[model samples]
Target: MSTPWTPTEFEQRLRAAGNERYHHRHPFNVRMHDGLLSPEELRVWIANRFYYQRNIPAKDALIVAKLDTRELRRAWIRRIHDHDGHDGDEGGIERWLRLGEAAGLERSALESGEGVLAGVRLAVDGYVNFVRLATPLEAVASSLTEVFAPDLMERRTAAFEEHYGWIDREGLRYFQVRPPQGRRDSREALDLVRRWATTRADQDRVLAALDFKFDVLWSLLDVVEHACAQK
Candidate 1:
C-alpha cells in the first residue's frame, strides 16, 4: 500500500492545490480586485454569484446528512443557519440580496433566478450533488476552499470599499462577516479531513475533491467572463 501522508504534508499539498487552481487568480476575479470591471460586468457577476450563494445552505445540508456523529452534525448544521438564518438573523442569503439591491438589481429578479446564468446553475448544482454522493471525508475536504476564503473575503471587502463606492456600504456585511466565519468553518473541516483521511487513497480522494471544487468555482467565472465579454 502507498504510505499515508502526515497531516502537515497533506495540508501542504491541499494548500498547494488551492494556490495553483483557486479562482482568486482567474482573470475575472483579477479584474474585479483591480477595480477594472465595468458596472455592468460587476452587476452580472453579483447576480450570477448569488446563485452559488443561495445554494450554500443546500450544499451544507447534503454534507450534514453524510456526517455520522451528532457532534459533527451539530457543528456542520450551523453552516446552514449561517446562510439560511434562524429567528431574526439576516443570514448570508439575505445579505447577498442586500448586496444585489445595492448594485441596483431588483429583489424580485434576484429571487426569481432571472439573473442566474445556465452555467452557474449547472456548476452550483453539480457541487451540491457531489457533496451528496461524496464520502464524509471528501465532502468535508472539498470545503477546504474555506481555508483560503477568509483572506479572499477580506481583500474582496477592501476592493469593494475602495473601488465600488456606489454600492451601499451596508451591503458589504457578507464580505465583512465571512472572513472569521470561514476561518472557523475551515478549521473544523480541516480537523475532520485530517483525522478521517488516514489512508493514501483517502488523502488522494480529499485532494481530488478539493480540485473539483476549484473547477466548479473557476468554471462559474469562465461562464460569467464570456457572458460579460459579449455585452
Candidate 2:
C-alpha cells in the first residue's frame, strides 16, 4: 500500500490543486480584475454568477443530509442559512440580486435566468449534483476551494471598488462578508477532511473532489468569456 500522507502533506496537495485549477486564474476573471472588461461584460457576469450562488444552499443541504452527527449538521446548516437568509437578515442570495441591480440587470431578469449562459447553468448544476452524489467526506473536501476563495474575494472586491466603482457599494456585501465566512467554513472543512480521509485512497479522493470543484468554477468563467465574445 502507498503510505498515507501526513495531514500537512495532504493539505498541501489540496492547496496545490486550487493553485492549479481555481477559477481565480480563469482568463475572464483575470480580465475583470485587471479592469479590462466592459460594462456589458460585467453585467452578464453578475447575472450568470447568480445561478451558481443560488444553487449553493441546495448543495449544502445535500451535504447536511449526509452528516452523521447533529453537531455536524448544526454547523453545516449555517452555510445554507447564510445564503438563503434568516429572520431579519438578508442572505447572500438577496445581496447577489442587489449586485445584479447595481450592475444594471433587472431583478426579474436575473431571477428568470435570462442572461445566464446555458453552459454556466450546466457547470453550476454539475457542482450541485457532484455534492449530492458524493460521500460526505468528498463533498466537504470539494468545498476546500473556499480556502482559496477569500483571496479572490478580496481582489474582486478591490477591483469593483477601484475599477467598477459605478456598482453600488452596498451591493458588494456578499464579497465583504465572505472572507471571514470562507475562512471559517474552509477551516471546518479541512479539519473534517483530515479526520475522515485516513487512507491514501481517501486522500486521493479528496484531491479529486477538489479538482472537480475547481473545474466547475473555472468552466463558469470559460462560458462567460465565450458569451461575451458572441455579444
Candidate 3:
C-alpha cells in the first residue's frame, strides 16, 4: 500500500492540482481575460455560467447532508445561504442576474434558462450528481477549487473593468464580494480534508475528486467556446 503523506505534503499536492488544472487557464477564460470575446460571446458565457451558479447551493446541500457533525453542518450551511440568500439579503444568484442584465441580456430569458446550452446543463448537473454520490471528504475536497478562486475573481474583475467597460459597474459586485468569502471558505474546507483524509488512499481520492471538479469546469468552457464560435 502507498504510504500517507505529511499534512504539508498533501496540502501542497492539492494546491498544485488546482494550479495546473483549474479552468482559469482554459482557452475560453484566457480569451475572456484578454478581451477577445465579442459581446455576444461574453453574454453566452454569462448566461451559461448562470446555470452552474444556480446549482451551487444544490451541490452544497448534498455535501452538507453527508456531514456528520452539527458544527460541520452549521458551518457548511453558509454556502447555501450565500447563493440562496436568507434573511432578506441578496444572494449571488440575484447578483448574477443583474450581471446578465448589465450585459444586455433580458432578465426574463436568463431566469428562464433562455441561453443555457445543452452541454452546459449536462456538465453542471454532472457536478451536482458527483457531489451527491461522493463521500463527505471527497465532496468537500472538490470545493478546494475555491482556494484559488479569489485570485481569479480579482483578475476577472480587473479584466472586465479594463476591457469590457460596456458591462455596468454595479454588476461587478459579485466578484468583489467573493474574494474574502472564498478565502475563508477554502481554508475551512482544506482544514477539514487535512483532518479527515489521514490515509494514503483517502488523500489520493481527494486529489481525484479535485481533478474531477477541474474537468467539470474545463468542459463547461469547452462547450461555451465551441457554441459561441459557431455564431
lDDT of 2 at 60: 94
lDDT of each residue in 54-102, candidate 3, tens digit only: 9999999999999999999999999999988878879899899999999
Off-target runs (Cα >4 Å) in candidate 1 are none
Off by over 4 Å in 3: none
TM-score of each: 0.98, 0.98, 0.98
Q: 113-173, model 2: which lDDT tens digit per residue?
A: 8878899989999999899899999999888999999999999999999998888998889
After TM-score superposition, the amount by which residue 84's alpha carbon in candidate 3 deviates from its true location, in angstroms, is 1.0
lDDT for 157 in candidate 2 is 95
**Tens digits of per-residue lDDT for model 1 on 97-132?**
999999999999999999688999999999999999
Kindly provide the TM-score of model 1 when superposed on the true structure, using C-alpha atoms.
Answer: 0.98
Alpha-carbon RMSD to native, per candidate: 0.8, 0.8, 0.8
lDDT of each: 0.92, 0.92, 0.94
